[model samples]
Target: MSDVTPKHAAALVALDWGTTALRAYLLGDDGAVLDSRASPAGIMKLPAGGFDQAFDETCGAWLASHPGLPVIAAGMVGSAQGWVEAPYVETPADASALVKGIVEVTAANGATVHIVPGVLQAGAMPNVMRGEETQIVGALAGDAALEHEPHGALIGLPGTHAKWAFVFEGRIERFYTFMTGETFGALRDHTILGRTMRATAQQDPDAFIRGVDTAKDAGHAGMLATIFSTRTLGLTGQLAPEQQSDYLSGLLIGHELRGLNEVLAREQSNLAGRTLRLIGNEALCERYRVALERFGCDDAKTVADATERGLFRIAAQAGLVRAAVRVN
Candidate 1:
């Protein structure tokens, strides 16, 4: 709790705990943030005392001050490696489904922490997510289009392992995961592509767009054939060492979009008129916006405050928070 948190304004303590970081939010009844805290204490890198200490560091004081504050958490904190293992809710699920899958863990402070479950898309190409499901809930909590549109919505949460979730009538019908950022790191740090690349403080937009254009024009051969150009272009003096990184980034992201485009085409649709939103880092989302514009989905916009809003939304769904009064 900081000086910013006004006296007794918090209605819920929400946490968005992930693989590499932990975010704690003190939220109001209306889903507004009253105060917040963040730590590098992700699930894998907890300190000597582990999850209890990590939770206490950010939330212990708040709980002491405001006894019986409703607490809810999302992300890897609820994974198999986390404090408690909440089972996965299958796809075509909604917030209500998440409520049905909630698991309760009594924290060190004796306060019950409700853990939100992850989503599993099972079958031949099985996929699972823990934290991103909460972000998706945050993203779609109060969107207007999802209320009336049959076409639904698409949200892109870009990161080391980027997840693009598809929502139709408020249910996550399906989604895709792209290891673009992780693969980019491995290629730039471990692969032969690292041999000719230099780190740059600034991004090379021209080189990045060049790689994207190459993908759009000649990518029918797929990424395996195109990624080699990152090295050859630098060796031939066509690309500077500093530019190769972003160019490779563009190449990888371009292929991702290309695959997404293929998926859309299979559904008799394209990015041209899709209702899309991006919920993640602003700068990375900006890069995605640029790449997406090139791919014809020009209307994508980044959303803010979705995590806290999502936690509150699910809390309300689970009867942990009182609903706001509505009048006709």
Candidate 2:
């Protein structure tokens, strides 16, 4: 860590380092982005002793320039196999819990990088998340209503493993994991359902909605039972090859939400009228929005730049950025 910073504007350097990709952010005093960077070098993708190299390559210059400008990293970079394991904070965990669980990795030059810990909901059916904790914090930062939603809000992070976190009073209460995205990928790439499917750049919203409606009406039989209809509809000419992929995607996502609603119903909480915030890619969140509407959920929106905001929020919590004001 050398003192090479030019303007001294950057207050923090944050990294959302996950399984397949890593993104870095330089934040100002107000948690605004001053600069940013990214790479494909995730923890799982790194080679032997490559973490140091990847770290240096991705944000070395920023760190070099800022010297001790607090560096904070979230995601798999803090997992058991990451640079250093940051232990999981249990459910009902808040930003304070994440700060308490922070672990550090020291560079050869004695620079310290703070790694944020993941959250775990311990129970018979245990659920865990790493990088998403930061995203959740970011979502909360973006919306005040979600933090205090009377019945708690559902924050959906849709991807390979979709996460539905139930937030109450600015804390992560409990969550559910839907393997919807990954299942769709497997069925599309390896299963017979993929054989007749054709890839296209154009989207078929009609076909997608149809699949969602079908899932809502006939999904009570369970996922495995209704999932097979994807191929049948195609075989019967109701779904074209080009429409099969999107249809299958809709089916999986629809089923995921259906299950989520059911689980909420069991807990005396319901998703139908709940305030839901989604965090993920634009198109994917839009798709989930449509599916949620189909399930009678009228209030759902996407939170942009959740990861960056969450990283900064956590960094500030850990006294890494935005130094506290002292009373005169």
Candidate 3:
């Protein structure tokens, strides 16, 4: 642990600890971020018995600065492979359900840690989501328009496995997952298409736009047949090698947007014409926005750092911390 002094007493500590990275945030009494620390100690990065040691190394100083400071974590840190398996909270539920599902552990020095639960949707096509649930909670909690929307909101959290949640009132009604980003990665790094795709293939706007158009035109019925066009376009001398990556990105994201539109239309009519509030990093959200606009869902907005907002709300609701911010 680095020897440093905290400028402000931390009201609580929040973590958006996931599969590949761990980010910690120190927040004040008003739920505003104060300071933060980070580590590469994602669950996958730690050894069998290293979670405790890693936590101590990363946040022990903050803990020392504020004894018994409540720590609330969300993401794969609560997965079966994490410190403790915080079970899934069923859908058609609210943030209260998340608070109810929290699983805790005690550090050797006696600090308490809370792991937020993932959300599960059970039905013909079941779906599960972890960190994204908290992002959704924070997004809704931070936006009064969304928090009080009469028709509810459609939340799209784009990442490796993008999650589309339909939140009505204050509860998450249901959600679906699209492995769009992961699929793009696989195609770019492991498949034959990668041979022609160089690093310069990213941000090729023309190729990406074409890919989105192809996905929309193909719809779900022809999706299985559409991806091959990435290679065929190159073979036919239509797609340049440098544009392959961007093209592939467009095709997959297009497929995701199209699938989301169809699923929402079929599953719930109330979502028609409503905007999708996107929660994620700026780049991915922009990509989704382009596809959504091309696919006729024009109003897509982005909310950065929803993960932090959510951790604060969950901790406050659970009485793990006292923040003056209102979360309804």
What C-alpha lDDT do the candidate models reach, one value each? 0.86, 0.86, 0.83
Q: What lDDT tens digits, residue by residue, belong to model 1 across residues 49-160?
A: 5999899998998888777788999999899888899999999889999999999999887989999999999999988888888888888877886455566788888889
lDDT by residue (274-296, candidate 3, tens digit) is 66699998988888887787877
Error of 1 at 158 (Å): 0.9
In candidate 1, clashing pairs total: 1
How far is each candidate from the true structure, as Cα RMSD in Å? 3.7, 4.0, 4.5
* lDDT by residue (tens digit), candidate 2, 1-328: 2356443367888899999999998887677688888899988999988888888887888877767777899999888789999999999988999999999998655568999999999999999999898999988985776866777878999999999998887889999889888888988999898889889999999889988887888889988888788889988989999998888888888889888878888878776777889999999999999989998888889999999999989988887775521100
The window of 10 residues in a row where model 2 has the poorest summed lDDT is: 319-328
Model 3 vs. true fold: TM: 0.91
TM-scores for candidates 1 onward, in order? 0.94, 0.94, 0.91
Looking at model 2, the pairs that clash are 5-65
Report the candidate with higher TM-score, 2 versus 3: 2
Query: Whole-model lDDT, candidate 2?
Result: 0.86
Candidate 1 — which residues are off by over 4 angstroms? Answer: 1-8, 47-49, 146-149, 323-328
